[model samples]
Target: MTNRFFNFNRAAPDARSDVSFTRRLVSDCVVTVGVLALFGLIAWILPAIDAPVGPEGIPSTVSTDPSNLPYYALRSVFRMAIALFISLIFTFVYGLAAARSRRLGKILIPLLDILQSVPILGFLSATVTIWLALFPGSMMGVEAASIFAIFTSQAWNMTFAFYRSLQSEPKELDEAVRNLRLSHWQRFWVLDVPNSMIPLLWNMMMSVGGGWFFLTASEMISVNNRTYALPGIGSYVEAAAAEQQPDKIGWAILTMVIVVVAIDILVWKPLTAWAEKFRITQSESTEPKRSAVLTLIRQSHIDDLLARILRPLGQFLDWITRPLGRTGSKWGAKPSRRRAGDIVFAAIIGILVIAGTAELMISIARTTGLAELGTAFGLGSITFLRVALLTALCSIVWVPVGAIIGMNPKVSRLIQPLVQVLASFPANFIFPFVVMVFVLWNISINWGSILLMALGTQWYILFNVIAGASAIPDDLVEMTRNFHITGWMKWKTLILPAVFGSWVTGGITAAGGAWNASIVSEIVSYGHHTLVAKGLGSYIAEATAHAEGMKTIIGVTVMAIFVVAVNYLFWNPLERLAARRFNIA
Candidate 1:
């Protein structure tokens, strides 16, 4: 029976064989139908549960009842899944485009840096009205805006991961590919993607965590005097906070924890285990990460059955792409044609930048004065200081903890999922509880806001540190033990250096996230009580709420400029230094 399940045999069949085949076919069909039915039910229920659209296209009502938590959690998960799928596609294309062309790479890489630095709140504030206008008097516009917000949260890091992987492809592998004359499509699927899979998976996990961190803000968006609460965990939490119901907030937190654990068990763990094969270093380690769910799926007859069913479609794709693979000409263009294309692209970009700058300047001049400019600059400096201090604090705490956890494979396997769940838990869900404590204790809003930003942003540092430390070779670890390396010496000579590259990556991401989190964290509210911190985030939030277009633009632009400048002067140099000094290869 095991052989029958594992082996694909086509030969003259006896009656017993025929009977077994028929039974297998029936089993496969039943499993497929059951899976489809489950997904179909979810799809059907989501629309039914969504609040009716109002005249202004916002949802008329959103339930905060604990009983509705399951449905709301499902809606949020579904939206995140959709956004993740879109992010994956974009990552592939954008990463490839930037990696393959020098001219495009120069342009695209910096563009990604700027895009990632642009606060999520900025994207929401700028695009929500446009999206609403596009799908007037319908929930579709709001849904689109929410999904896009999530996508912005998730996509940039994934793209950077893939692009870095491609650019850092081993010289020998690059030579082999050139010698083999692999087609562009073939190279991507067979070489680039598989080679990049490990880091890409890790970054993808981080991106999902980020999506969840900001999920509440995305779902319960307030922009330009308009508030739309989508039926999701985010909106549920928002409603709970608004009602000042600690019990409901607790329920939402519990529901989110359960949802996150379920996703890890069913999706991420299986994918992580499966991606082990794609690791570029073929050296066998002492112990590999294991997943019971993945093992069970692999051993199941359904796995073989699905492979058999999908084999024909896979074959058809190969057949259609065969001609392209055979012709190397498809991968190249004439020098003259390439030069012309570059010129045209540059011209278009230049025109757009000039027009955008002119329009922005005109708006700023018309609506913003010297006083407003000074206020924005002052508020921005306050936010910048908070980001810097918080990022440093996170690095100091998590780097050592992450290094310790990562160096122990068994402990890491046990604890990583829990950490990820914590990382993904929306900080906003606990705002009511936070408000209660602060109100009772009379704590400063500024300090409380800093703590909130830390909670939301520190995971980037922790997870990246873990990834880096986990990648350290067994040989290096054994050597360290042989030398009796311990304590601060061990950290300095072995662990810290090993994880430096990852630390830099994490710090950059964490700082960017901190900047983004400010818009929500700097202003805390529960029912009639509100605590406003003095920062750029509060400035932008206030501007957005009042529909002060020029103020919002000025705040967003100033923040973006600061972020981009820091990246260029500080993070970029540190990244290069880490790559040069600490990278194992």
Candidate 2:
């Protein structure tokens, strides 16, 4: 009799048989050749582009012609790809460090919270000069700066997602891994990563959208009378807006929409479907999502080739870490000594925090007087109100719509990719249209800024709600139907509670993103006319543009403090309530 627990299915044909091997080799060769050809094409065209080289060897000018749209889009996508790769690395290292050490997590978690709330504009203002100086005359410095800005936008939320997932790992699985005596490295790959896959993937998708939201600001680097435009869709849109050409703006928007949709179809959807298998639940998921691309890949000879390639590498890693696993306990200090070490670490952190706070206060005191401080606080209040009101409005609209879409699998499959594309649309690209309308209609900057902020932020709520709603168990749905639960009763009891955790998570991210978007949304400019709103975002933007280090730092520091305070007093408590009281077991 076959052992059900450890069956190998020996009846299957050998994957390394002569015919199978030949097919796998051919498939891999084709893939390799296609990738090389694509790279070659990019290399051939890059030098021919008409961007002007500066005395310092950097590209100082950007081409705005419609003909350059494809090249610009490709450059933007490449930067985003590099930033995403860097974000992933940061997420793993930082997230794992925080998760593994309770002592470290106390400082790391709150630090990450503050970092997330810090605006992309703040990063650009602080780091762009440094990056430019680092690279001297090369455009590589500008590229690095732009990529780093995008990284700030994308990395924090992913790190949070990974940390939360790791912290909430199933206790039974935790015990199982410990009993098996897996090394830290082994546990990370076999347990932590797999368990966190679904949430991490969803957060990663949102991070990509967040990166796009800041693309224009990052790529069109303008500060202190100097402007450096890296050839990208962001700069394309900015140039169109500057020229006041609606047709070119429309083209840019269209091109962006196409790229976002393609990425969703080719990358995110398949990854989401694959991640479903990793969900840790007591009852097996019923009729989980299916991806046509995933199915095609799985059935192809290329799959066999990948398996053969990865298998040896995976084995080699395990072998390399085997000794560490065996000798881990021998390397650790005794309990008393370890406790002393933790105390010393905590003391060091405390001293650093106090010193940093003191220095910041001294800097602000020297830079500006009471009037400037009062102005910053008052402007911060305006931005806060906008974020709060817009967040509430977005929740009201998207929560129900997301619930309806998520309840039906067919509808979800059709609409999820569309939502992703919408989320990933650079909200700044539509700023020209908004500015044009506001200018013609005589609308206030206050309301116009709110609308732009909402446009960039609402999709976070929508996508997260969909993910939560989709995870609702079939058995639970059947039970609700069997009980004839309907109307408000059904929503109050079933749907609302089911998606509460996700909604809170989405709200937190959306709120942070809105605060970041304020730097652009609060200060709208079209051609020669500019509308500046009374808010901290505008303050930061103005300060950044003038390269006023003290004012920029003060504005950013005040905004960060406000955001951190709100998160602690409001969002943090709400998240905890949702997790404890509303989450489905």
Candidate 3:
């Protein structure tokens, strides 16, 4: 009887095991189906992009109906995703190259500054023709132009963050790479990239928000009185605003909130949880971070199967990189040979830059005169005053607030998604209301520009501060608490010094953002009343709107000059100070 009972139990257990296997198979199949559906949807989108342009040859048409919101959201998200991928690639190549060698950095760094300082519409005005030429009579051209504009807004922020993080690399890590016989290429991929992961992740989020801020301008723009629009959330907002539909505007904001939350849950949370492992600590964290998505993937058979399929590709990359990592005999071996090579490289770059400058100057002289140049300079000076004061004001307000938010992990996690949504909110949507207020009160755009610029740029400082403060080691916080360090001394000794490097980074980018925001902020339009500020931003805006390429170039050049001067006179020295005074690693 006992043997028979045992046999029955064993058979029942076997049946349950079989049922579990069947469920696992079904789960894997579901994952497979979901992935295929995603690809199918992408395939659907490709045809829409490649379709021939309508008679207008710009926007075609965008529907503002609530039912169409999902499609528009998807389109905008897709463009954003593509731009982000391009920006990531650009950040890696440009930031690494600048950080790798001093001689190269002298040229690349300033070029990056100039590129970032150029306003969004300036880029649109300059690059739109080229994109149209590349894809003549196709919507692809308009789409490409939009993506390029978004890339310009995003790529710079990430590049700066990556470059700054590389600059702060620990000496010990460098020594280890050398001791491990890792060459320059190997060190970059294996050591440098990993070390900068935290900063890169945070800055990438900031870059996305920055791109979203300009999405409206990218999607719907007017050049030389020719209107171009696209099918996206940005275009939807533009259309609704034109019709003065407050309900539609409210709906758009609600949709934007949904998208932001969805992205946070589906993308950022998993990445953030995974990045926790990269934090520099002497021991494993006592409380491990968790992500449902990461956990699900870990348990999924599909992940392992895909990894196996991609193993060969991974190995090929590793193999290809190994040889490139080798140092040339002349590099870092002899001082004279290295100096000679550097001089030759510098000379070649200088010749190219001079040639470009000569051509550009000739064109500028033909299309514009010395008077135009003088006018631009005067306008730039005014904008410069506003940008400087506004940046200072933002820093003063956000620094301590960011520090407080950062130091509290519980609060940081709770509020970070909300911050992302807010930062990503398009200031263009708020312009009408602001302009209405100005019109009612008979206020000038010159004074109102301050609020607009601050609205757009202040988040840069806040985000950077939170990133810096969150990185403060737990032991340090505990030690300060043990010593009863509080009030001004605590801030002076612990908080300020800890976040100094981040502040410098934030301040530089915030200043750049203000310069860019000035393009829209300096010029506002409501139903009938248009307020224009007497500044470089309005100068550039007018130049771009008229399709006066030479004038835009002049405006950009003057802006770059101001930015270069500010960096040299202020930011560079602060960067050095942070490195020497606070860079313990």
RMSD of each: 5.2, 4.5, 7.2
- In order of TM-score, best first, we have 3, 2, 1
Candidate 1 lDDT over 316-384, as tens digits, reads 665676676642344668999988988998899899989998887776777776478778889989999
TM-scores, all candidates, are: 0.87, 0.88, 0.90
- TM-score: the better of candidates 1 and 2: 2
Clashing pairs in 1: none
lDDT of each residue in 1-585, candidate 3, tens digit only? 111211212123233344466566765676678679879879988888889977855653467898888888888989999999999999999998898778779888888888889888888888888999999989898899999999988888788888988898888887777777765655766667766776677777778888878888888877665667888888888787777777887788888889888887767776766666556656544445556665444334654455566656655665687765553222454788878988898899889989988987788778787688889999999999999999899999999988987777676667777877787777677777788889889888899999988888888888888777766777777779899999998899999998889888889888998999899899877656689999999999988888787888899999998998898899989999998998746
The candidate maximizing lDDT is 3
What global local distance difference test value does model 3 have?
Answer: 0.80
Which numbered prediction scores highest in TM-score against the true structure?
A: 3
For 1-585, candidate 2 gives per-residue lDDT tens digits of 011111111123342344465555664566567568869866864553333447666544567799889888888888898899999999999998898777778788778777887888788877888987887666677888999999999998778778766766667787888877777766877778877676678788888998898998889887765677888999888887888888998989999998998888778987877676565555555556777655444334544445566667766776797876531244668899999999999899989989998987787788786478778989999999999999999999999988887777687778887888888888888888888889999999988899988888887788778767766767788788899999999999999998887787788778888888899999988888799988999999998888787888888888888878888898889878876788665
Ten contiguous residues minimizing lDDT sum, candidate 1: 6-15
Q: lDDT of candidate 1 vs native?
A: 0.79
Query: How many angstroms is residue 49 displaced in model 1 relative to the true structure, after the best TM-score fit?
Result: 8.6
Error of 2 at 412 (Å): 0.6
Q: Could you tell me the lDDT of residue 238 within candidate 3?
A: 76
Candidate 3: give its CA RMSD in angstroms: 7.2
